[model samples]
Structures are given as structure tokens and as C-alpha cells.
Target: MNATCEPRSPRAVRISSSPAELAGLGTLLKCVQAGVGDVPALLALAKDVGDTAPRPGAGRTALLWEILASVTAVDVAAGRILEPHLDAAAILAQAGGAAAADFASDRVSDRVPDSVPFEGAWGVFAAEAPGLTLEAGDAAGRTVLNGSKPWCSIAAQLDHAVLTARLAGGGRAAFAVNLHAAGVSFADPKWTSLGLREVPSGTVHFEAVPAIPLGGAGWYYQRPGFAWGGIGVAACWLGGAVAVARSYQGALQKAADGGREPDQLALAHLGEIDRTLAALIQYFARTAARIDAGELSGPGAWSEALRVRGGAAAAVERIQTLVSQNLGPGPLAFDPRYAKRMADLSLYIRQHHGMRDDAQLGALTFKGGHPW
Candidate 1:
């Protein structure tokens, strides 16, 4: 062994907020709005978070999530429940790993309601490939992916996708493929029962076509950013909750001024939703801090993150129930926007991995094996 490898004390790494990060995020959001999906812009955004290094702490995932969140915030500000846009933001945040936890919290306050959509998949296909039999291959030195990906939010609008596929060697890989590439196609854009109708989500098909590799094969799951994707999904749900509460409050104010009795149930529901958002923000903040400090390493840290995500999913379900009940048949009248908002929230929150049976099983396995 090299003498230089003698046991060394771990150096303390401080987790400080970066104004530059915030500014960069703002600039990137503007570019996204301007249709600047050029490679130069993407690379520049990557560099802002130190994405080119051997191990770029949070990597591209964190950047993607922040970008998504900012765009969703823009939509929320415009009073439109753009659930697909919000889902995109969540997916990007979870791409890199737990490193996005801080990025998510710090930037949530700055989000604006912009109508731009992200051009990448939310990593659902890639993350689920190992167990789902999703497949990819190379044809004539150009990467090709073939599979059916359900619930690709913004599929119709996106120009490209960072798609994931399995290798012949029983491993996984990812590639960036243009949606307009030869042999690539999408199913008819049908509106779901839920409120977010603009997403244009549908199935996508791929025959052998050209694709640019993302990270190395098998690197998608093993990367830290993949786990953090849940946090992004959680943040989007929380944002939806915020939108619902705002709508309820506005309705309550109108009823009060009109000499109508306040909807006591709606008020109570708003309180519960508020409480959940507060707790989630605090939990995510602490988790981010711990991960930054390197204290949240190993299986235990991942388990805790999963628990947070599951809890967020449950809170969202409760909020949706309460909102629908309080709004009553008024939302269904087609005049009030409450119904649409509720529909958007319902569809968006259901996108999380925790909503699946296997996700629950995975969480149980981690918790049972280690209490840390």
C-alpha cells in the first residue's frame, strides 16, 4: 500500500447556499423560455453546477430538476395547473441523486409560472428498466432504443428524450434521441380523466435509430442522482398542494364576502395540506443537509429518502380528497376552475414511484435490513 494512503481524517465539507447557483438558475429559466435548447446552453447550465467532473456531486439531475421546478412555478403563477410541466421538473431533480434535495428546496421559492416544457423523459423508464424488461441496442454504431414508455409527460411537445434501454449483456444504458428521429413515433395524444390536459402524454415507439449515449452503461441506476428523482416528484406534488390551497382560500374569501357560511371542511383541509407541506419542506431540507455533509451515505440514507417520498404521496392523496369534497359540485359546473386544478393535482401526484407496489416493497426491504 502507498504510504500516502495512511488513514486520514475526513475533511469537513460545508453546505453553503450559492447565489451564483440561483442566478444561474434564473438565467437558465429565461433561456428555456426562449427556446434555447441548444447544446451550448445545456453544457453551460451543466457547468454552473460542476457537471463535467469525474463525479459531479449532484450532476445533471439536480440541474434538470431545478429547471423543471422553475418552469412549473411559472405555470403556477399564471394560475394554470400545468401538471406535466411540474412532473418534468420533478424528474430532472431526481436524475442526479440525493444532491438535488437542497437544490429543490432552495429554488422552490423562486419558481414562476412559465409555460415551457422540458425535452427529456423524467427518468422513469431508465430507473424501471432493470426490472421492467425495457430494452435498447446499437445499430451500425448509432444507439437505438425500443420499448413502450407509458405516462411520458409532455411527450408530444418534447423534441428529444434521454431514453434508457437494456443491453444484451443484461445491463442498462441511456441515450439522448431526437423525437423526430427516423423510426421514432408516439401514440395519439389523448387527454386523461385528470385536469392537466395540456401534457399530451402518450406511448412512444422506437425502432433502431441514432442516439447519443448519456452516461455509461449501468451508470443510470448506480448514480446518486437517480434516487434524488423522488425528491423532485415530491416537490412537484407539494407545489400542487400549494396551488390547491390558494384556490380554496380564494373561494372561501368570495363566500365570506357574499354572506355565505364558510365551508368548514375546506378550511380544515387547507390547514392539513399546509401542515404537510411545512413538514415536507423541513424534512427535505434536513435530508439535503445531511447528504451534503456525507453523513447520509449507504442504504440507510436512501431508505430515509424513500420514506419521505411515500409520506409526500400519502399527503397528496389526502389533499386531493379534501379539495374535491370541499369544492363539491361547484367545480363540475364547468365555470369555476377548481375542478381543473383538482384534476391536474390528481394526475401529477400519481406519477411518483412510491405509487407503485414494487416501490413499497423496495422501501420495506431497505428499512427492514437497516434501521439507520
Candidate 2:
């Protein structure tokens, strides 16, 4: 209500994704500088007081902020906000245990250490992908890690990170690593121009590095909270999608009211885009509510998480394409918000893993009770 859709997102949610109207916290947008397309301004938003840390059940609102922030900050800021939520979820899953969760629980709660950047490095790029090789051997009573982890975001700037590695015997174990520890070094940044350049993600090399072992081998991925965290990433994607599509909102509205001139050919595309956005927004709202209610569990949870993620990724691709086609070169060339958002969302959703991931959902579906 404060302004018409800003050719960005969040400012005009009332006109798009109803029932999820973005209100207040408009300050999060200033975190980006369109002309520069960098994240220093966005990163500055994290300098809030200790009380600014997210509390329990703040995931949905946090996700909305992630979306809103992406409209301007180009997802670097949103991603910074998102990783901590995931860290909290992981720790919250292992609350009673004193294993690796203890380290995470100690740092992720109400009084989390302020301004410490954390990244989650779980993706592997090697086709052979033996995974981050780790031996169970002891080094003077300290756990020794040797190998590399791909997608370690901003390891240079990050003080700590959560990682998953393959043990000598082949089972996967999770660890909280100190980037400043001895023998920990980062490969030159491999991520170039896929849109999230500000994130600085690449492979991190560890030679006899020290790490704090967290939960058991399977706890990192098997826990219910893992699925919830997956949904949070989808929320970020949807946020970026909304921001990208706002470029065509006026066209969409005029088309809906009978296009007068100039863009009559875009009418059908605009209408379809509107419907597509409505459905995606509804699904996003439902999933976020389920997460907040702790209703996503049982064997069906991962199935449902995949449903949200896959659907959001597809919707984002569709919206980005339609918006670009309908609006032509004006926005993508002159409007930094639209250009950056399109690039960011398009790249970020690549986390979906394509058919390889869909195959996991297929396996779940064949087992029945698939919560679609």
C-alpha cells in the first residue's frame, strides 16, 4: 500500500501474492545499490544488535525477509540470513544430544555470536565425487580432516561453516569447521558470473584440518529439520521470482482489462503469468505455515519438501522468462533491480538438482503415502 509495485518485489505483494502481504521492515531493501550490483551495502544490514537474532518459530517471517531482501540486496543478504536459520534448525533438531549439535546449539540460539558468517557446504561437483575424504585417524587427540568441500561460501570472510564429509569407511558425517584453523585453505573462487557472485562459493581444501564432529553419520540429512530447511531455500527462490515478475505487472493488469494498444500480443502471457504467480505464492504460504506449525514430518516430509522446491524452481524459471519476453529490453537493460533479480533467482534455483533430485521424489512416490 505504501507504493505501487516498484518494478521490484515485496513493495507490491498485496497486488500479487495475497494473504502474504509484506509489511514493515522496508529498511532491508536499502541493502543493495542497483547501479553497482554489489553486496557491501547488503552485508552492512547484519550489523544489528544481539537482540536482532532470530528466535524460535521465526522461520516464516525470516523467509519473507529473505525474499524481500533479495528484491534489492541481490540474494547475498538474503542468503546470509537464510544460512543461520538453517544452522538453527540443524541444531534445534539435535537439542538434547551433546554430540556435534552442542557446538551448533551453543552458537545458534538467542544469543548467537554476532557478525560471524556461516556457510553450509554440502554440494559436490565431481562426477566421481568420492566426497570430502576424511579418515578416522587421530592427530594428537584432535580430529584430522583431509580433502575438499565444494560450495563453501565466502570461506575467506566466514569464520566457521557446517560441512558434510565422507568418512574413511564411506558413511557420511557432518562437522562444524573453523576456517581459520591450521591447514584450512580456500581454492580460488570458481563461481564466476552465475548471478550470485557476491556469495563467493567454491571448493575449500583441508589438509589435516581440525573439526568439531556434530551429530551421528546420518543425523544431518535424516533429521526432520533438514526437510524444513529445504523449504526455506524454496521460499527464497519464490521471493526472487516475485521481484523479477513485477516488471510486467502493469502489462499484466492492462492485459487483464483488455489491452488497449502496443502490447496486445502479450495479453495471454501476462494472464498466465498472473495465475502462475498466484499458485506459487499459495504453495509458498502453505509450506511456510506447515514449517511454523511443525507439521512437516513423517516419511512424507521429504516428498513434500521436494514438491515445494521443485514447484518453486519451475515457477521461477517460468516467471523470469515471461517477464523478460513481455517487457522486452527496457527492464533488463535499464532496471538494475529487474536485471539483478532475474540473474540471482535464475542461478539460486539451480540448487534444485534437476531429475536426479526428482528421482528421489519418484522413489518416495513409489512407496505410497506420498503427501503430494
Per-model CA lDDT versus the true structure:
0.49, 0.57
The stretch of ten residues in a row with the least summed lDDT in candidate 2 is: 119-128
Error of 1 at 253 (Å): 2.7
TM-score of 2: 0.76
Error of 1 at 144 (Å): 2.9
After TM-score superposition, what is the CA distance of residue 277 in candidate 2 from its true location, in Å? Answer: 1.7
Candidate 1 residue-wise lDDT, 1-372, digit = tens? 000010111111111334455455554445433432243333233333323211212333333333434433323221122222333233344344232332224332233111123333222334342323446775655455676665554555555455577777787776545566567677785765655565445567776655545557766555555555456555556545555555565666666766865655656776887787677656655666655566554545456657667776777687667666776665556533455555666666566665473466475675584454
TM per candidate comes to 0.64, 0.76
Model 1 local distance difference test score? 0.49
